[model samples]
Target: MKKAEVVLIPIPAMGHIVALVEVAKLLVERDDRLSTTIFIMHPVLDPSTTKYTESLAASTLPDRMRVVNLPNLESNTEDTKDRNWLNSMIESQKPRVEEYVSKMRTQSQLSPDSPQLAGFIFDTFATGMKDVANGFGVPWYVFSASGAAFICSMFYLQALHDGEGVNLTEFKNSDALLEVPGLANPLPAKLLPSMVFREDLLAIFLEHARTLKETRSILVNTFLEFESYAVHSLSNGKNPPVYPVGPMVKHVADGRDLRSDESNKYRDIMEWLDDQPPSSVMFLCFGSWGSFCGKQVKEIACALEHCGHRFLWSLRKPSSQKGKIESPSDYLNFQEILPEGFLDRTLEIGKVIGWAPQVDILAHPAVGGFASHCGWNSILESVRFGVPVATWPLYAEQQFNAFQMVIDLGLAVEIKMDYWRDFLGDNEIIVSSDDIVKAIKHVMEEDSEVRKKVKEMSRISEKSLKDGGSSFSSLGRLIEDMIDNIS
Candidate 1:
């Protein structure tokens, strides 16, 4: 039998890349006749994203699977705040990506040992490739690096806007509750998604939503039992199938670790955790799309200091770090950028570093709480490790994830629960030191309600991955279905 060579086009960001890479690994692990070629698009500003991709390329992956970085020719004309740039930049890569895939297909077909092009699998942001996949007469699948609720929300938003001619932005500022079928709690219109904030992004985001119907299936990075309502809402006989094969972070038990490449940077972090008592440290991290500003970082420093909680913060610089270099304040160390005497005063109690071993830290016994941006991947990781959260969302359905995690799952405490934080714009959030202090205490204090719930949820998360379990069965079916699609 001929093997299926699936070309994966990920959304060129760290979070999206990590999720789809795990899917590729899962696909290869379960099938002898399958292989993947992940075509990574070049990301903006952050050199770490590029380096991370390159590291994956250089790593020892399975022979049937490999990584290829697309050319860094994408234009950087658009400002980071104008997120339409991402949609546009991804759109601009279509002709080049299609051309590259066509060439790859030609070369591989000339060799008998090389696999036939089974299809293309793209991250939700790379949905423009749907046309390319159709042009080549092959299957295309969309991988949503979020939960089932998010998938339903996006598609439902498109249907609502296009079908009814309603203004989603208008609803965003209104007091109405969003009624997505699968979620038990009503999603506030204000917390819908960052794309709703800008009128220009509507076309592209809807492009992502509408194209899902054209694909063979929708693959989400979530488990079945966890998001049953949202997953169920996505299912109908006529619509594309939805599959859940996730909580797919890498770990030693899987004989693989995603952050192995960053082992050197994280070794120190692990050693620091070793010295702390069990369940004593609060681990703080925001997703790539949302990092604290210097002013906000200082506030966090002050909060950590005042609250007297032992903590480990995985800090990220703003994306436009190069632009900030003109100022003497933008230094190499976070300590350099922090408030006067902040580091010295809290040196023993809280350690703030520029990067961290996130999964490793969550798995560490000393980490009791996660003050997170509530990205779906982070939520899953925290749950898997029995770490409760202080929901502090930044952007892009993160508020949706945060609200759901707190209201729907009862696994987290709230930091700034009701509001939406745009991309450091007019309506951007400024979380005060006092609020942070309260939130951290709610998460880290022993025998808190959130902690007890998270511990229970963690057991459920683990059990779902076991054989004959809901997630396990779902994954088995997903693999079987993909194999059937190959024929």
Candidate 2:
């Protein structure tokens, strides 16, 4: 049998691209008959995005793999000032992607393995892959960068056929608790993803949900055991098989001793962890795009100070109109944005940095809890390391992810919120320092039920990732399915 020439297309961001690169490396390393190539279709060009692509390409990989950073699509736009612009940008990028796929198909026709272009393994956000797969007459696999729960939520669209989708924004103002069929928890609509709340985005989701039937298979970055109900529900009668191959980070781990003289930048974080007491440090990071206003920042800082726990916080410099990192001269100073004397006072117990090695920090013995935005990737990484989460879902599917974490899976806890009273009060309601302080204490204190529940989830997480475990077996099945389908 000849090696299948598999092409990979991932979403534009650094994190998404890195995961796809790792998956391509794994496939090539596991099968001698597999050769992989990656086509990075970035929709925009900026300093950070450029650096992300370069860094990803620099990462270690199998010799048989190749990576291509393609030119930005002509239809892409930089106008993110309005939400409508963002939606238009996504819609416009499709034609440019179609053109690129046409060129790739033409090039593949010239290869020695001319007719063996195999199939496409595409990021979930790259919806244009369906058309590309149709052009080449090959199967298309949908790769989800998040957990199985996120994927299962889309299946609820079948219920939307009966009536209008649940309007979370309206529910947030009313007393109604939105009941999503097939979900284990009956959650308030305010706790749902923004897409589910906004009508325009809800339409987009419904369209995508319908597309699931066209997929050859769906691959999630999670284990079946961790979200067995979700995986089972989505796979029940679907044409596309749902494969839970995950904790995807494990595939990228080079398990030498943590003290090895490896030149990786994460080495410094590991060294710092060695000095802290067991489970004493809180790992604080919101995913790449999560941002907060100056007021929210101050409240978080105050909460951290009140907790009196050792912590490592990743603070990002906001971007200016020209897309450059805002300088100290712009707006308020960092100190002003933080609570009064919070940093100086907590210097003995906490360390604040612009960025840290998140995965390494979570795996450290000193790390007791994760204060996160509940991004799917971050949540999965926390689960993999047995680090309990203090979920503060900022946007996107994060609210839904947080709901599953606390209510469904009992893996973590969410900061309590009274949506009707808070956001729709007689006066404008705001989150206060008191709420933040209470939530932090609940997640970090040893006696709290939230902490105990997370500890139990951690044990289950360990078993899910072990050899011959759910995630491990799912990965093997995915590989075998692809190999068997190759002509």
**In terms of TM-score, which candidate is strongest?**
1
Residues 175-288 of candidate 2: C-alpha lDDT, one tens digit per residue: 556555436777665665566656666766666667766788998887776787777777777547888776666422565454563654456667777888988888778766
Off by over 4 Å in 1: 43-45, 74-92, 107-114, 252-265, 319-337, 419-428
**Superposition TM-score, candidate 2 onto the true structure:** 0.84
Predictions in order: lDDT: 0.79, 0.68
Report the number of the highest-lDDT candidate: 1
Q: Taking the tens digit of each residue's C-alpha lDDT, what string does model 1 give over 286-339?
A: 865556667787888889999998999877655444433111112377665689
Against the true structure, candidate 2 has what lDDT?
0.68
Residue 333's lDDT within candidate 2 is: 44
Report per-prediction Cα RMSD to one decimal.
3.3, 4.6
Off by over 4 Å in 2: 44-49, 81-115, 161-174, 250-252, 255-270, 317-333, 416-429, 447-467
Question: What lDDT does model 1 reach?
Answer: 0.79
Q: List the residue pairs that clash in candidate 2.
A: none
